[model samples]
Target: MNKAVFLDRDGVINEVLTDRVKFVNRSDQMYFFPGVAEAIRLFNQTFDYVFVVTNQGGVGLGFMKEAQLQAIHSDMITSLQKEGALIQEVVYCPHKPKSGCTCRKPNSKLIEDLARKYDVDVKSSYMVGDTDTDIIAGKKAGTKTVFIGKSDPLADAVYPDLLQAAHWIVDDAT
Candidate 1:
């Protein structure tokens, strides 16, 4: 079985644009957070697989089409590849929070699906993200959780950003 590093997309990978107030429907809006690619590269060196499990409620809100989301993801992948990191897979829930979908964060359906499709060892995997939902999903998936923010108290471990979290992961592995 493979150990994975699950990541969140919006706030964790790209800058969380609360003020942008607009849904990220275009590739231009998909900007990488500082050191995010570096963090992924570090994980790629250590983990057997790296996956992205994100909650994209904008699609459910009719703010963007699925194709637009794919375009943005493609651009993100291209950028990450340029940085020498490869995101093994990207999974997102398009349902609104009110939709009660099983795939949404705080739920483990996405991880479960990935485990079924890929040889993921839930017990040995890790989840890194910037939100409570991300930690909760990791917990539900039976993986250790690392929070990528100084403010979130729900995380098992907290760091200022993804790069710091990556450093922690590297330290822990040694």
Candidate 2:
């Protein structure tokens, strides 16, 4: 079975707009955090699949159109690719928090679906994120959870950012 690493997009990959605490509405607003590209490159080399699983509720809230979100993601991918990082796939839940969507973070539908589709060993996989919901979903999906930034009791480990988390994952895997 293949091993995968699931990542949250907002704070994990790009800097979150502090004022809104939401998605980057414009491509120009997209700024990758320090060392994110290098970290993703490491993940690409270490895991069979490096997937981005994020909750993009800005689409549901009408804060940004889906096309705008796509543009931001496109730019982010382009930047990472230039740095030699290849993300296997990106799965996002574009539902409002109260939409009762099973695909949202804190719900395992997205991760579970991807695991089955990719033939992933969920128990051996890792989920890295910067939110409580992210950790909850990873735990529910049966993957080892790593929380970036804030502390979380549910996380298997916590790191300041993705680079540190990547280092831990790589070292632990061996």
Candidate 3:
């Protein structure tokens, strides 16, 4: 039984461009939040698997190409790896919100898929995200939910940011 952490990309790992009104369409727009590298480095030491679950609807809506998204992820991963943090895998839903995608946030399909593929113990895992949809997805996947940013009534725990959430997870595991 392996413990894993499922993290949301935008707003969790990277800064979200609220003014853009769409997904991060350019690699130049991808910037990691403060302490995100340190948090992920801690997660690398704490969890058996660290997975990123994101919804890149921009690709489906023609806001950006899939290749551009890949480039952004590549840059992010490379930057994190340079800081000694490794992300095991990144799972994304490349569908528009109206596409009825089963793998998007608020749906456990992607989480379930990762659990099966990685032999994860869902019960002991954690899902950390900035939105209620992330909390719902974690709940549906049978993992503890940690909400970043504003508090959510449905979340198992709330933190001001991903770094705080990481600290809590590490401390709780011990």
Query: In angstroms, how far off is 126's CA in candidate 3?
Result: 0.5
lDDT of 3 by residue, 1-174 (tens): 899999999989987866643457887887777899899989889899999999889889888888888888888888899999899888899899878878888999999999999999999899999998899999999999999987799998899889989999888766
Global Cα RMSD, each model? 1.6, 1.6, 1.5
- How many residue pairs clash in each candidate at the backbone level? 0, 0, 0
Model 3 regions more than 4 Å off? 18-22
Q: Which digits, one per residue and each the tens of the lDDT, describe model 1 over residues 15-125?
A: 766665244678887767789888889988888888889999888989888888988888889889998989988999998887988889989888878877898888878
- What 10-residue stretch in candidate 2 is worst by lDDT? 16-25
Best by TM-score: 3
Q: Give all TM-scores, in the order shown.
A: 0.93, 0.94, 0.95
lDDT of each: 0.84, 0.89, 0.89
lDDT (Cα, tens digit) per residue for candidate 2, span 1-174: 999999999888888867644458888777788898888888888789999998989899999898888777777787789889988788889998889989999999999999999999999999999999999999999999999986888899999999999999888766
How do the candidates rank by TM-score, highest first? Answer: 3, 2, 1
As a whole number from 0 to 100, the lDDT of residue 145 in candidate 1 is 85
TM-score of 3: 0.95
- For lDDT, the strongest prediction is 3
